[model samples]
Target chain A: MNLLVDAFAWIFDPAHQAGANGIPTRLVQHLGISLLVLLVASAIAIPVGYLIGHTGKGRTLAVSLTGGFRSLPTLGLLIILALWLGVGLEAPLIALIVLAVPPILAGAYSGFEAVDRRTIDAARAVGMTEWQIVSKVEVPLGLPLLIGGLRSGTLQIIATATLADYVGAGGLGHFIFVGQKSNDYPQMLAGSLLVIALALLSEGIFALLQKLVVPRGVVANQSTDVRRPSSRRVAVVGFPTEERK
Target chain B: MNWVIENLPLIGQRTLEHLALSIPPIVLSFVLSVPIGWLANRYRWSRGVLLTVLGLLYAIPSLPLFVVLPIILGTGLRDSVNVIVALTLYGIALMVRTTADALGSVSSDVTQSATAMGFSPWTRFWRVDLPLAGPVLLAGIRVVAVSTVSLVTVGAVLGIKSLGLLFTDGLQRNIVAEVATGMVATIALALVIDFALVLAGRMLMPWTRTVSPKRERRALPVDEAVTA
Candidate 1:
């Protein structure tokens, strides 16, 4: 109990506000590194995902490999990259980009795949080129899922970025590492709370983003089907029509 | 290469340790999640709070959690247990949301018809809802299992002997072979775990297999309508 209070007090203390080093300045530095990692990851992944989804060829293999990459432990990856790249923020950043890629790719592929086939066909029937169908139709329709993947990926990168402290790339993780070494419970808790707050804030922001971007038509379709009178009348006479559809 | 032959025994021991740490969490989380999911669904407002907490939990970085646990729980297995507890918390959050979403996806008519047929709420849930929701729930579980297998390595960072220690030590010592061995072992474990879950998903949810036939037939018209 005292530990919790002490930790809170330490965090709020003006003298300790940024650590012996400027705290806000250090946090922004960490955040900048994290965002840079995420941006690079997104740039690599979104294009690859878009290509795979648009082409719809070898998507299974591409997605499977990406999933496999995602499952590789980030700590292990960080260690390996640190060894190969010789530490600093760059190694961890590279490792995180690899970690982030899979989800973004999978989300993009699946989202595009889920785009109503009719919509794609409708576009094609009107003589829309393949590029046009993708950029205008499939991409727009798939934007929500892609964004969801980005949201998840961003959160993941931020959470995992703390591990970078082990390699001398400073962030909130510095507090955690230093606290662990010194047995400073308050400092450790302060860092943990900051991470928790960051995570929740990001999730809320993304959920709101999803609300803003996801097509209204898709939402209406999902809810309206739920509310249909016939939905309540299940005869068990047959499987759900929508399932078949 | 010589390191491989010399450390063969260590590699085997590490594999066993990795499996020990990873398997228990996956199984424990699965067993706990089903009931917790049901409870969350039963309570409305609390469900929202529970999920919010879980989402936050899921976002927690593993290393911080590792360090924080010792402060609260002393050290050693107690610390590891904290990791498990944290993982389980995240697992329940994911499972509950997925389970609820799958259950919600079940058509209302199916529920109404089951109710009309004199099936009790318990019976409807067990015989109907559980079976239909099995695949979706399994998908979530599969994800959790793979992730937990990877996470067990992080558990090793806090002096829990497992594959992570091998990798961490190898990197520190610049023992390339040990690092390779650990990476290979971890990846192999992930693949095996994932394969086992996929097989289990298929066996437990036979409906998943049968549903495809009808879906294929419906695809033809949907395809045609779109093309036209």
Candidate 2:
């Protein structure tokens, strides 16, 4: 009880503040690392996903590998990366990227694969280039599921970012790690609260993004908003807008 | 190569250890989730609350949960119980939604006919509702099983002596082989578990096999009609 109280106090301690007000420095550092990780991972994974999803062959292998990647332990990966990269932020960044890639790749592949065959065929019949068909037809149709994958991946990255601190990469996890080491309960709780807050906030933001990007018409038939909690009326018109006939 | 030859027995032991940790949680979660899902389905209001709580539980990270549990419950497997509890919460979140969705998917006419024929509510649920919902529910369980298998590796970080322990220990000791072995074992175990569940789902819900036939017939007409 005393430990918990003290930990809270440390979180609000004005002198130790890392940012504006009493916001901890470690949290900012961790969030930055996590963002960097996500950006890098998405850069690599999205293209790979697009390729594998679009290509008819080797998809099973690609998907299986992605699943394998997802199951790898973040902490263990970080430890190995830390050894290879020599600690600090880089090791955790590598680990987070590896962790984040699989979901994004899977999401992209599944989303692209799910694009209605008729829609793609119609797009091609209308003289749209293959690239244009993918960009204009397949991607739009697959947007919701793709965004869902991204949302899940982002939340996962934020949660696992805490482990970065264990490898001396320094994030909000630092507070928790420090608290655990020193038995400072309040600091640990404060760090944890911040991590959860960040995760929830990201989830909300991504959910909103998914709603905005997904074709309004497609979402209307679904009862559950798999992406966001907000009930917005998005218009989803049935495919083949009639002119193709 | 040399390491493989030298530590073959130890690698085998670690593999077994990993399976032991991963398997029990999945089985326990599945066993518990089914009953909870059934109960939740029976009570509409409680179902919503249960689902909300379980969804929130899914957001909690394993590491912090482990750390907090030891503080609250004291050391060892008592602390490890947090992982089980959290995993079970996740199981309910996923399984309940799937169960509810599956049950809802059962045609109303089927239920109405059953009721009209004087079948008791209990009989309707068991003989009709459950059978129809079986494939979808099993699909959900398959997902949960795979997730739980992966999650159980996290238990090793808290000193549960699973594959995760091997990785953690290897990292701490700077023994790359141990970490590699542990990771390989974890992946292999996860795939095996997932395959086993897929097989089980197939065996238990035979209707899923025929779904492709139904889908294909619909697809043919739609494609020809639309193309024409």
Best candidate, TM-score = 1
Question: Please, what are the lDDT tens digits per residue for candidate 1 over residues B20-114?
Answer: 77777778777777766666665667577767777767776766666566556665433557767666666666787777667766666788789
Docking class of 1: acceptable
Report the lDDT tens digits of candidate 2 across residue range A60-176: 887778766656666667777887777677778778888888888888889889877887888889999989987878788878878878877887788788877777877777777
Residue B112: error of model 1 in Å?
5.2
Candidates, DockQ: 0.37, 0.26
What is candidate 2's lDDT per residue for B1-228, written digit by digit as tens?
566678888778877776665666677766676667666665667677777667666666766666555555554433556676666666767787777667766776687679889999999988898888888877787777767766766666546666677767876788877777776777777778778888887787776765676677676766696887
Model 1 DockQ, alpha carbons vs. true complex: 0.37
Candidate 1's TM-score: 0.84
Reference A-B contact fraction recovered by candidate 1:
0.40
Task: Tell me how many residue pairs clash in candidate 1.
Answer: 4
TM-scores of all models?
0.84, 0.79
